[model samples]
Target: MLGRLNHVGIATPSIARSIETYKTLLGADVIGVPFDLPAQGVKVCFIDAPNTQIELIEPYDDASPIAGFLKKNPAGGQHHVCFEVPDIHAAVADMKAKGATILGEPRTGAHGTPIVFVHPRDMGGVLVELMETPQEGAH
Candidate 1:
């Protein structure tokens, strides 16, 4: 079972601009900017929310996943909802067993985090991401 909605990933061409917009318009507080996984080609800034988070995702490379997405939709917007899961592998397995379509195998995400994506069709047209909490002392 899922624990809680961890964060909502927002695709943005200019994270700096987006951060300012969120701060001025939505009063979102910048929690932190973490860079621990260059392999993922992402630079992330976490913004706190009442019950979730606004994760600004800026692709470090043109080939980054988010970059490809932005190519199709220039004005970046809400990308995905990441759900915190106690066990990502198990959660993915369960979702698969229940006929959910998976986008990719479980793998490391930004900040060296374990993550996976379930296809939109599986979650009623909303792309969903599953991530395990960073193991204590890992980050």
Candidate 2:
């Protein structure tokens, strides 16, 4: 059902500070350049880890969903966990059959891959993102 743990998303008030923490404290390498996804309304960056990556997400606007999260947390925290799936449509169906609450329709994510989210309540209060494997020479 799940391929692998793709990335762990960390909600942060500032990506620059998080990058420094990952570099200077965690001794991270291969830090990705931050990019803005206006559609998702967030600025994101990735820090490569041995087994998985750390996604640092910051709200792009006041209307950003992360902004709402930050309002409650103020210091930001673990936003979500993303896992890879071989076939997202099949995965979606499987989840639906099992009575999981799919958050929304499948959409192109930051990686330009088809992805969908499962509701937190159904996943024991952890937001889960299911991402389809990015194929070679494909979007």
State which candidate has the highest lDDT. Answer: 2
Q: Write model 1 residue lDDT over 21-121, tens digit each, in one string.
A: 98899887756774534577777887878766788888888778788889987889888998878888888888889998888788987646789988888
| Candidate 2 residue lDDT tens string, 1-139 | 4488889999999999999998999899889999998888899998989878899999999989789889998888999999999888999999999999998899988788989999999999999999997787642
Give candidate 2's error at residue 2 in angstroms.
Answer: 3.4
Q: Alpha carbon lDDT of residue 112, candidate 2?
A: 87
Model 2 pairs in collision: none
TM-score of each: 0.84, 0.94
For model 1, what is the alpha-carbon lDDT of residue 85? Answer: 82
Q: What is the lDDT of every predicted structure here?
A: 0.80, 0.90
Model 1 lDDT-worst window of ten: 29-38
In model 1, which regions exceed 4 Å deviation? 34-36, 134-139
